[model samples]
Target: MIYQKTELGQRAMKDRHAVEITRAQRSALILLDGQRSTASVLDATLSLGVSREDIDRLAELGLIATMPGSASADMPRGDAQLTDFASSTLAARHGPMDLPVAPNNEEERVRRYKKAYPLATQITATLGLRGFKLNLAVESAQGFDGLIELLPKIRAAVGDERVQPLRDALEGR
Candidate 1:
């Protein structure tokens, strides 16, 4: 998702050397760089866990630039340096952003876990049950484990039960 620069973003850009951005923001920038509308950017960024406010702020800070109508330079460019810069800034300001959390309610959790289950299952399967089970147990034994350990750490983390069924399953419940 690409977010265009608003006047605020332009103004912010004029003064700042670099503005912090979340991983989603960076991905949005890569996807919706040149000629993408603010709305598109917002949609894309939101999907990646970035808030519209953050995108707007990044624009205001001049870290992201928005152009109109398919301009090549305006297109989302995948530059490792820019991504690194944005990631670093976000880390400094808010810390690292990573996996989605287990939802609070069963329905939401199920929905979220369903979305993530395949991937988690795939990884665990690749690692083999014994290894995966052992790893998960060790991590959760301390109150959190594996991806669950990181989910609550990200900003705007959601709690879902469906996604956690695997965690429960691993615990032999």
Candidate 2:
């Protein structure tokens, strides 16, 4: 069976391993881009001293997974739909948009709320009922999972290209 890197894996690579991963693990990780087979990855990483254990470690970290043939598959979906929805919604209304920066500590949260409120209020006013709900949702969002769950709704309110910056801010990156 072949394994592909998850979004978290891509984030790890892009962020230069925010998690505690070994050199061998990183070596093996750079090879599982959804196109390579397990055997091919093993061969490619031979000089880097990568092993099956490294691959297993990535899987354990939820950084990689097999494609959708197995019973216990965890395939990610809805990105395209979200993008489409965001595109259409923004195009219909056609106005200036200000993205909210997520807050970390309590002090930052206060600052963030101050900044986000005016923008949210202005935008939401234009959107009517949906806008009001989105403003409340943005203010009430909790952690990473909460932010991710709210991403689709946010994109629908804003646009497709703005969520990553907001997520990065939320992650304190």
Candidate 3:
């Protein structure tokens, strides 16, 4: 079976390992869908923070697996819809209801930040009714931008009746 790391799985692994992992190791393990070889895994580990000895030890301990050459008929087919649904649900429930950190790459960063903004706004509006205040630092443009970006979504999420007070506050009315 191909193993792809879920966010929860990654958190569990990190908590269990408790050791710092190299970026390369993280990338390799994430991409391992049961097809990459030991050498590739090793390279990935090396790229991350792990030594050869550690990689060997992990493999020996059955933490990492080497894919066999033959494909198994019993393996589940890739379920894109399921994956998307699960990811969205997880993100909504567990992910920070705020702009994510700048992504590793420009395109991805923009995409994720854009996607997270509206969701965050919606969540924040729900919280605002309970008197949760937003914290935006003077030195952080991104923080301010995120707050401003979320205003419209928050308004929309709150709807006309519940959002008037918020709008009054924002407009100093």
lDDT ranking, high to low? 2, 1, 3
TM-scores of all candidate predictions against the true structure: 0.30, 0.39, 0.24
Alpha carbon lDDT at 162, candidate 3: 55
lDDT value, residue 7 of candidate 3: 51
lDDT of 3 by residue, 1-93 (tens): 333344544563667565455443455555555565443443333313333444444444445654554343322224323322222222343
In terms of TM-score, which candidate is strongest? Answer: 2
Give the C-alpha lDDT of model 3.
0.40
lDDT of 1 by residue, 69-105 (tens): 4343322234324332333334444455454444556
Which pairs clash in model 3?
22-48, 22-49
Which 10 residues in a row give candidate 1 its minimum summed lDDT? 150-159
Q: lDDT (0-100) at residue 90 of candidate 3? A: 27
Clashes of each: 20, 0, 2
Over 4 Å off, model 3 = 1-28, 70-173
